[model samples]
Target: MKLRELALISSGINERRNPQGTIYYIGASDFVAPSLLNKLIKPSIMPSEKLEKHFLTKQDVIVLGKGHNGFVGHTIVDDSKPMVASSSFMVLRDFHVKVLPKYIAWYINLESTQQELRSYSRGTALPSINRTILGDLEIKIPPLKIQKQIIEIDELKKQESKLTTQLDQLKTIQLELLLKNKIKNYEQ
Candidate 1:
């Protein structure tokens, strides 16, 4: 099934910052690869009154619409606070009953799909992925049970990667400490 048939695809908001703004603005910088948000830095503030319509909801899929490095997609799992994506993103919402937002996000983040999206990008300096290209892209819709299974597996892989990184860091620290002790004993 084509993506457009599965969900509504629309461009994000284009607005300037307001110091006293109430809503959080999510830009390309706030997003990390493989469907993660970098929450270390606070998002920019944007006024809420005029931009209420652009507020993001839970399960909304956000896709990078403009960039030289190709597009990245992620699902909005949290909607406890008011937040909106910037102009560089395309928001996918109101999904069909057969589809899951995370499933679509996972599909979009696939390496092969990234390459395909890059091919559709226009312009030489800063390639951009527009709504039309995104809408026409084909999507595979499996059973809901399978979709849930895929999402669960992806989460497990991510956890494994995180732990492996930590283990490597610990090993490096242990080796450094061992070397230091050996040098001290030799000197003594």
Candidate 2:
């Protein structure tokens, strides 16, 4: 099914104005973090009250509407705090029951999908991805139960990977300490 069928896709802040209220402004450059927007050093501002509607919420997805050189089609999910997205992104929310936000995010950022989206990118100065192009994408969304299962498994894998890395570091430290102790005894 097309992405539009699974979620409410809309452009973010497209107008130029100064900060009027307390809000976070996220631009294309802020998307330097891939996959998920965990650390956003986005500038804080006081925007118009109306712009509150564009504030990102949990499970919201953001797609870079412009820029290339591995920037276009950059998709990230906002499972974090609410923040305003810049005009450079297409914000997707109100996901259908069948779709998982992270799943869609990961799928969009896939090298193959990014390749296709990049192909549609236009402009000589800066390549971009149009909303229509993104909406027309047919993505396979599994049942909710399956979606949950997939996400859960993926989470476990990530945790395992992290733990493995930490363990490796600890092992290295242990070896270093063992060698140091042996050298001290030999010196004694």
Candidate 3:
């Protein structure tokens, strides 16, 4: 099914900053990966009432709409505070019952899917995927049970990668300590 058929695709808000604003703004730089976002620090204040409609929820999936590197991120905002993505992102919400938001984000973040998305980008300097192109992109929907399993496996892979990095660092430190001890004994 096409993405538009599964969820409502809309451009993020294009508003100026307001000092007295209350909404948190998420920009392309905020993403650490296609599925992760950095902790919110300072919030962008937009002095517009229309921003209420753009407020992000946990179920919303944000896609980098304008750039050479296109990626998608699942929204991780605190529900206590209102938040909205910047104009550089396209928000997908109101997903169909047959699909899960995280599953959609995971599928899009795949290397193969990312390559396909890049192919649809336009412009030379700052290639971008317009709303129509993004909406028309195909999405493969699996059974809910399978979708849950995929998400769980993907999470485990991420955890494994992180743990492996830590282990490598520890091994390096251990080797360095051993070398230092050997040098000290030889000097003695």
Candidate 4:
């Protein structure tokens, strides 16, 4: 089924230079997976009226629009609250129950899917996927139970990746210490 049938694809807030009433803003680069908004980027205030429609929730998926082809399909699962995406992102929300948000996010971030997105993108300098392009994309929905299992497995893989990185850092530090001690011994 088309992505629009599963979720609403909408443009994000167009930030105003100046306006009345304050609302939080989130640009495409402000988020990192597994990290909440507070640490990645600070929220800036825009006019509430300007932001009324772009408010996001934990379920929202924010995809980068205008960027290098490598980043065109880059996306973030919006686990953060009380914020809105800037014009650089296409916000997806109000997902249908037949699909899990994480599952769809995983599918779209897949290398194959990203390649397809790049093909559909437009621009001479900074390629971007507009709502129409995003809306037409298709997704296969598995049983909800299967989707849950997939999500669990995906989370485990992400955890394992993080642990592996930590272990590599420790190994590097250990090697550095051993080399430093050996050099000192040689000098002595």
Top candidate on TM-score is: 1
Model 4 segments more than 4 A misplaced: 16-22, 34-40, 69-81
Q: What would the TM-score be for candidate 4 when compared with the true structure?
A: 0.87
Question: Which segments of candidate 3 are over 4 A away from where they belong?
Answer: 18-21, 180-188
Positional deviation of 38 in candidate 4, in angstroms?
Answer: 6.3
Q: Worst ten-residue run, lDDT, model 3?
A: 71-80
* TM-score against truth, every candidate: 0.92, 0.72, 0.87, 0.87
Q: Rate the local accuracy (lDDT) of all candidates.
A: 0.88, 0.74, 0.82, 0.73
Model 4: per-residue lDDT, tens digit, 24-141? 6776566555323546454567555646666777767777777773433333444444677788888888889898777887778778888888898898787888898888888878
- Count residue pairs with overlapping backbones in model 3: 0
Sort by TM-score, top down from the best: 1, 3, 4, 2
**Judged by lDDT, which candidate is best?**
1
lDDT string for model 3 (1-188, tens) is 99999999999887777667667787888777555667654576854667788888877888887776665556553456688888998899999999998898888788888888888888879888878988888988989999999999998998999899999999999999999999999999
Candidate 4 or 1, higher TM-score: 1
Using lDDT, rank the candidates from best to worst: 1, 3, 2, 4
**Model 1 ranges off by over 4 Å:** none
List residue ranges in candidate 2 displaced over 4 A: 15-21, 35-43, 69-82, 156-188
- The candidate 1 region of ten consecutive residues with least summed lDDT is 39-48
Pull out the clashing pairs in model 4. Answer: none
Clashing pairs in 1: none
